[model samples]
Target: MRGWGDIPHFIHQSAGTLRNGPLVQFLNNIDITIMNKPADYSASEMKQISKRYTTVANQINRHRTNELKNQTIIFNLSESFANPNRVPGVKLKNNPIPNIEKIKKRTTSGIMLSSGYGGGTANIEYMALTGFAMCNFAQTLSTPYTQLVPYLRHNPSIIQSFNYAIAIHPYSSKFYDRGIDYPKFGFNKFFYLGNKKAPIIHQKKIGANSYLSDETAYDNTLNQLSRHPQGQFINLITMQNHLPYNHLYHHISHYKATVPANGTIAAQVENYAMGIHYTDQAVAKFIKEIDNIDRPITLVFYGDHLPGIYRNSMKKDGLKLHETDYFIYSNPAAQRLGAKNLTKHNHYVGPNDFIAMTA
Candidate 1:
């Protein structure tokens, strides 16, 4: 698997990422420990590589045919994490999935079932969008955002079939260098807090980093979509619930943290709950506004990964992280046959399986 990096380079970049071109900029800054020099290939080999890429692409596109064509799809990569149930000893005043029971009736709901892999947002986003896990490449070559996303010229996302596709992140485009990578995933438009043309959200400070409120991000997304009349795929990666949760939000005192006072963990726990509360409220508000849209729409919301302050389910020795919650929401307009009522899924949903399961 160590030598297999070149295969993705050839399959994705036509020859290898060594040549002077779009991907060369990324390759130029590489350390040999991760990637050595690319194998030299003749021009004839480059032609063959292109042919192979086309053949593979055609086969994949054929196998993964799009199911929902005209329906609007919004996939929100919510930050941090929280479970549906109350953490023992903590009082949660806010419903994380606000009115989830009521909203469940309006659409199909289920757990996106994820492994306790501490891969973070970029890896999960790659899996959810491509329906392939990090293990597809070697785990050592982790984070497709930096490794694979920079090389690809095309994508196989379910949203490729949509008439319009856009990406919005209420954070820096440079955070993961997503500014350069999203286009490779077939996003027709990209908006971020760093982009002046994009709607800027008033951020709240969570520790040293400024966090954009989910409420404002949702409104900006809605505003962006208002011009497009459905058949749009919107990827919203949120940032409000990021780490350094030591600050206190008085409004959420009702959902007080039960952890020991004066510890780093206690502050994180308290601030985290408050952050989750705000996220829940944002979802409720987003739902209320989008429900009025005349076109059919499907919204999928899931936490990117568990935050840094918390530990996995294991008390002494456990590698597993507690799975985050994910729910698929179908508005009245997008309800399909037999999907009039919310459906529950019993199986665990891998991040890669999100596209197929949600569709």
Candidate 2:
């Protein structure tokens, strides 16, 4: 991972004018025809439908704001529960943890962020990349990675906002049809688990599952940036610290859960804390590397969803299940771009605003 970052590949981005105009028009026409009352609509009707669809679709695209330039962005989606104490404005009233006040003291910087309930990572995954809710596409709520993604080709994605985009995951491509969806979403390439496994740091088990550490995932993303330093975005989704905290890791941490220390639930909570600690270390390392580097980078780091653990850290703090955590971390270059208010408190964002928040 260390050596990978030094190697450099210079990439120049070419201008992208809409490439699937006719295809989009065709789909829009179909949509219009389906919406209208069924009649023996002639070829002339189809022509009018096509024309209308093209006009409306074009109008939609027109609303797209400009992309941020000269800055590399990384949307790093770490797994599982993001303790709300880490963010400001979180309050615990209904379901307070045993020692939440002390827990809050342990929290670092950033704003509290959340995604909608259920649908696992795909819910926020779709929203963050496409900036359109799963509900927006209807079928997407059910089969985003499989059916919906393959069907929507050349739709507007934040990927197009950057000159180059790459998706990095340290796990199998088989899950969630990412191999198909990522490309269509405009990612230039991907770094994921395959025949040749990814080189990950802290690859040890946190609870029961063996995971590719967040540190490794982030480092690989930097490695991608090293390969192509100019005008790039890296979407790094991690797999470490997933769920099912029923068992123990081969090499586990002694960090105890803040809750009463004797039950099965206590064990699970402690396991999550230990995993969170490792994630925190990895994040610190990742941030340090960016700070020392010469590249102009803007990073959006957050949890995709809450881990399906019993003591949801949110419940302890009186927050909803949808609320996980998110933050935009940028260097000096990005800060100058009217993003000075990033560290400002009370951001309170959701998955749908991911695109706008980063920009």
Candidate 3:
């Protein structure tokens, strides 16, 4: 099978009856082992891979980490966040994300080359946490969270460097097999909507029919931060700006989009923009809340991917559609501790570069 999406059809066609539970389970295991088998590399290819890693190791060794010794790091992955202006023939009456735009001016900010366009949120998160580029993997190795992470014996990640690290997502933990995969990545705790150990403390949804707002996501993050006095690494994924952009918000932003499509797409675009606006305001508030804390703190914020809502614009924008916003900001406390020069301005980088850049 090409990817996880093909498994259902494969099972339907090959497995005649679902009544034989043991037989089905046996076949499933065989299929998984075959699909996720590691590639056989020649001696030359192995040499090249070793050389690449050695070079990376040398580059990392050259950097000084004294500035970051006392800083708490937070990775904020925003859902379906994109620059609306990237869409062709689209015109915004006003900027939907003024706060982020302003913050980008003075910090290490740039456009990240996202691996997926409309979806595949997990892949981006995987790269950010692991510092491994998806482009190096075989094309069939799609949706690694389901196809690969479970079978692996060890999954190395940035979380391993921290004594206290947690992941928080304001949605169901079951998505992308994260419920099974997070432990392998070495997260101390994973918080989500239905997690029994650390259930989501802030579950306030936005609009009449929408996912939880970023404000509540930040509240939960702050609660987690407060518990860890020394320091912590937080991976927060916000769901307020997620899909089904069909008038979820009561009042859409005034920033109008003029896609060369029907009214339905336009309405969706506007609603998505409104969600971005909310995130912008919520992020400003979050940054302010953390600024007063005495300890050093650094936040790495970025959009996962553009919303799949733009069918016509996706084709027109091409590679531009794959570029989303990213920025790294250290608060006053971190700056006071010689953290001002930790990150430099980068115009373009891949999602895999985030962990390396921050380190």
Specify the highest-TM-score model's number.
Answer: 3
The candidate that wins on lDDT is 3
Clashing pairs in 1: 113-349
Query: What lDDT score belongs to each candidate, Candidate 1 first?
Result: 0.65, 0.60, 0.79
Stronger candidate by TM-score (1 vs 3): 3
Worst 10 residues of 1 by lDDT: 6-15
Q: TM-score of the candidate numbered 1?
A: 0.73
Candidate 3 per-residue lDDT over residues 278-312, each given as its tens digit: 89999999999899888888899999998887665
lDDT by residue (1-359, candidate 2, tens digit) is: 22433211111001011322444433322322212334877899999999999999689668654346567888877777467333233222222222322323333223334543322676577778878765445331344555456676575778887777888888877577787778788877767776253343334444355776777777777677677878787888888777755564533335443442223255665556666667777776777778776767877777776655534345554355556756667776555554443344435666667676676
Q: What's the distance in Å from true for residue 325, model 3?
A: 0.7
Error (Å) of candidate 1 at residue 319 is 7.0
State TM-scores per candidate: 0.73, 0.67, 0.84
Model 1 Cα lDDT, one tens digit per residue, 1-359: 22534333322232345444545534533631333335785788899999999998788668643446667888888876555243333334445456654554455555554543333677778788889775546444645676656866776776677777889887778766688778787788888866776655554443344677787678778887687775888898888877656654654465554542323265566667767777777788888888788777778888766665644344632323445767787776766422343344533566787786666
